[model samples]
Target: MRGQEMEHVLEAEGLGKRYGARWALRDCALRLPTGRIAALVGPNGSGKTTLLHLAVGLLRPDAGAVRVFGETPYENTTALADIGFVAQNTPVYRDFTADELVRMGGKVNRRWDATLARTRLAQAGIPPHTPAGKLSGGQRAQVALALALAKRPRLLLLDEPVASLDPLARREFLQSLMGSVAESGTTVLLSSHILADLERSCDFLVVLQAGQVHLTGAVEDIVAAHQQLVGPRHHGEPIDGVATVVRARHTDRQSTLVVRTDGPVTDPAWTVHELSLEDLILAYLAGSDTQSNHEAWGVAA
Candidate 1:
């Protein structure tokens, strides 16, 4: 599946957004292919939410453009209809029952599947007549997700969907989510701070930091392309075969650097180690302050 060619479901080119004096996102770009679960990782205020909004047309870009399935999203009904988005808060009407929300989804979306929504709610143990506001955080999230899934959208966007749930609830929510994705083959772009969950749920990764795209690619390719090296401290000179130095640390006797490269590290002086998703993410986030040209590695737009 990793080598299979798929259509690009979402594409952002030189995207930017600003709030008066501050640019929340700038020169950001990424391509999410169909049929893969992509994790969007960044620290607070790194513009994860901003980027999601831009993709869904909830907010327009101040620069560049974003497209969904090759069409611009803003005010484009076809493009909008292809996407289902659940915000960070997992919003639902307080007075509306779970059944009503499902009905509402049917009314709003041309392709809504009422049976799917009902079945998902039942599977989650959420009663049909329970008012959304009366539901627990986990239940609310489930309902929100059900509503999104019922739309039968080609692309689903979730922003920190499990941030407020407990560990058990988080597990259940993600399980339901992955199950839905598997059955529907929907392309998903999810943003969250839960590294462990992301590591388990996603195959593709996009790391944003300080308003820029630091890394974007298939998780497997990204991991294979980067390595962590620890060795004796010396003048910080560039290493051959290393494409980009993601992060570096130096002590009196030892130096450590996380680097992106296309080939193996042949030097014997440095101890090379593999990096987990969490390790790679943190290393990129730690180097967020540095400036460089944006590059989308494994998957091209």
Candidate 2:
């Protein structure tokens, strides 16, 4: 609407999805800039999968809209072709060999990179002749990654790609993902239920709760903006425009709060403590009272 529109690979506004009477995702807005691995973290039923599905055009939104690579991907074959998606459980043809999967991928995507796919699997020691169903979970996951990466997609979407992996396998998958991303500079939206894995690999952060985006920003900025302030209960906390309380616990004598603050804390009675990425995420997930806080613990409606 103004100067050049932001260079976002994925942009969604007022995005919503529903199933019968239940809203799977409601009034969501997100902008994923180029080349950032934005972690889409939420609990098991927190609409993470729903949002990913909407993005890849697997499921149409019931309200609002989503665009990929500057075009809505739903039924847009050309748009989907420029994107790579690794679904949950890393599903590949159970009956197809690793090599066959590669060949199939080459035919499906207009821009094929058979060498890249084969070379990646070959380097990972995945036997091309073996059927994918016979491979170990980690090996299968690697083959899935290889397939997605070989698409040379500008944007890659991964939905809980490591949920079923052991610790070692998860680490290996994430490492492979990061290395390939660094090499290709592909913008990625990786959804997960675990914070530790996302923290290690993702620079951008998004927190979703009950089908709404509770918070989104740079990981460091988010961690830096939130703090736990402990002070006298009678003094009252500074919760206004600059300080919005995300969570608070008050005793007769003292009040402890985790707040997203943008200004200096001048109250001498309060002791400020920094929040870890995990702590910050948990606070928002557990926060309450929609009408009370205006500055924090919220995203655009």
Best by TM-score: 1
Candidate 2 per-residue C-alpha lDDT over 128-228 given as tens digits, one digit per residue, 9 for 90 to 100:
99999999999999999999998899899999999999999899889988998999899999999888888889989888888998898889888888888
Local accuracy by lDDT, each model? 0.90, 0.87
Candidate 2: list runs displaced more than 4 Å.
1-3, 234-242, 288-301
Error of 1 at 167 (Å): 1.0
Query: What is the C-alpha lDDT profile of model 1 across 1-301, one tens digit per residue?
Result: 5233347888899999999989999998888988999999999999999999999988989999988888778778888888899999899998999999999888888888999999999999998997999999999999999998888988999999999999999999999999999988999999999999999999999998888998999999999999999888947676767888888888989989999986777878888999998999999888854334333343333
Candidate 1 similarity to native, TM-score: 0.92
Compute each candidate's TM-score over C-alphas.
0.92, 0.91
TM-score of 2: 0.91
